[model samples]
Target: MSTVLTHVTDELQSIFDRARSVAVLTGAGISAESGVPTFRGGGDSEIWTWRGRPVTELSSAELIATDPQLVWEWFDYRRGMLTSVEPNAGHRALAEWERRFEDFTLVTQNIDDLHRAAGSLNVLELHGNIWRARCLRCASTFEARESPLEENPPRCLACNGPARPDVVLFGELLPDGVFERAEEAAARADLFFVIGTSAVVYPAAGLPITAKRRGARIIEVNPEMTDISFIADVTLLGKAGELLPQFLKERG
Candidate 1:
């Protein structure tokens, strides 16, 4: 991955200098750099397996409704693991980027709060945070700082009803008003960056494509080539932790 072509680098600098608003989209790869497991791929978490089958199937609304205890157990295990991990270089750099630019928008597909933990402000979470739970009856949110609840499938104290992790699960729609803001940011950005995402996931995937079509200069940073690589004006092929800091030093 030694091909850091000069012409592409120069174009990126030009875009950075002139762009009025910038939008960034991050995926599982960024958090993976911080040792957070990617649910579906090679870096998938070991805790997601139950009786030799992946517990990921339980991360849906139907499962939560039918077997709430199982769902809570899975989420509790994940949250415990998240508490031990720290934000990596990529997360730190993006946090710094948020400070440098005035009209910057960050949209992430990850459910972990690593971006916030890294000191990034005003981030839009396409998938809700794993550290939070929402009450179905009361429509209130609670943050869990400790480990799993003593009661499997914690209840909402207010309504004494069922509560589940705030994340958008399988066959569930994204939370109200998040995707709209992401779309608005993508459409309005003068510079759009697709970082660490495969560009295959929908709604979120469409943001970069929307930005590209709207005339924003697209810059992609990933260790491997992604679907959006072909459309990027500068495809910096490397890990986000390695490439982002270098890119900032050279062109931030």
Candidate 2:
């Protein structure tokens, strides 16, 4: 192994051996490798040329209330994108880690459901999944089906009113119960890993720092340097799918 990998391997082994609790945060880059399109710009046709819409415009709470149809159309497009993709090697590695480590927590920002698809059991999705919908009236949540809705917007079975994706939209607060659990996990972690994220998104971005403040060793695995890299005790600069397997091998 090269110098960087050698250092990272040693650091990870040391952390895993000592840590009773571990937390892992993942981002879009990990899913991108699994054939999901990057949110760089418009539709697939203008992949490289077009600029993408802001998250706020696409997910504003106001937009969902005032123009539910528009928001639903946007979600439909996103759903199509997600449906075409599958979990990659990195996702599987995390799932395997969860199986091996009894106290490991897998936290993700993406709403693609790839982590669950890869067999991860203990996951906290900071942003909600697109595959699930929630009733705006009764708060009942259910898995979205492939069939078309009869109305412009789908109605909830419980309340017979409009239902929206369970995801945390722009201008909407994060799910109350989920973040609390993630924070607790971070605070108790002895080892924390940040993978595939830019570490720019708030609240979620603060998770690693929370663990760091509590004396947990931080490791970053990414192909490019991000804001969190400076805080990481060891930085493994490579694709997560490739790096994770190698790191685990070194541990063995």
Task: Find the candidate with the highest lDDT and give its number.
Answer: 1
- Models 1 onward score TM values of 0.90, 0.88
TM-score, candidate 2, is: 0.88
lDDT of 1 by residue, 86-159 (tens): 99899998899888788899999999999999999889999999888888789788875568576666677678
lDDT of each: 0.82, 0.79
Candidate 2 stretches greater than 4 Å from native: 1-8, 40-55, 147-151, 250-252
Per-candidate Cα RMSD to the true structure, in Å, reads: 2.9, 3.5
lDDT of 2 by residue, 1-252 (tens): 112442345656766767789899998888877877666422243233222656457677987889887777777776777776789889998998887776899899989899999999878989898877899889998887553444547778788888988898878889878988998999999889998887688898999999999999888888776788778877788888888876467434
Cα shift from native, residue 45, model 2 (Å):
10
Q: How close to the true structure is residue 212 of candidate 2, measured as C-alpha lDDT?
A: 94
The window of 10 residues in a row where model 1 has the poorest summed lDDT is 1-10
